[model samples]
Target: QVKYLNNIVEQDHRRVRQRTRSMLGFKTFMSAAKTIAGIEMMAMIKKGQLNIPGSTPFEQFYALAG
Candidate 1:
């Protein structure tokens, strides 16, 4: 049962692996971390996972921004 769980994590890591491969290298780990964070955040937003209760993600973002 636990053996199958790693596949889920590996699948998630595939996106980051592909991106890093395409970019070759970053100047610093911070830059790479920020890029990965942004990519994951965008994925979550696109999947409607980042939206606030009773609000769209864009609306939640705007509310937090102001």
Candidate 2:
């Protein structure tokens, strides 16, 4: 049970790690927070996690941006 739960958590972290790996690192806390939030938002859109009522992820993201 514990191993199963840990795998689930690790999978999620893997996505974040892959995305951030090219950036080297963040210089400030605020910048890191914003960048991570944007990354997560994009990931959610790609995963169809947001219900913005759009046929495509780009449209959904635009709606949220406005």
Candidate 3:
């Protein structure tokens, strides 16, 4: 049976898959996991979920980094 409920997951994974396709080699699972984590983190930041108080998204990253 075809499950339509997982469409949301497939949609979310599309970007991640595209990102991985661009990259060359991942030596191991740990490295791949780290890459995915970084991709998701950027996605959250872009969505403003990780924005710091009183700062725009771009500024928030700078604040966190510096």
Structural similarity to truth (TM-score) of each candidate = 0.68, 0.75, 0.65
Which candidate's lDDT is highest?
Answer: 2
Better of 1 and 3 by TM-score: 1
Which residue segments of model 3 deviate by more than 4 Å?
1-3, 56-66
Model 1: lDDT to the true structure:
0.75
Clashing pairs in 3: none
**Cα lDDT of all candidates, in order?**
0.75, 0.79, 0.77
Ranking by lDDT: 2, 3, 1
* lDDT digits (tens) for residues 1-66 of candidate 3: 567869977876777888999889799999899788777766778867786778777776656545
Candidate 1 contains a number of clashing pairs equal to 0
State model 3's lDDT. Answer: 0.77
lDDT of 1 at 48: 79
Model 1 Cα lDDT, one tens digit per residue, 10-32 = 88777778777878689998988
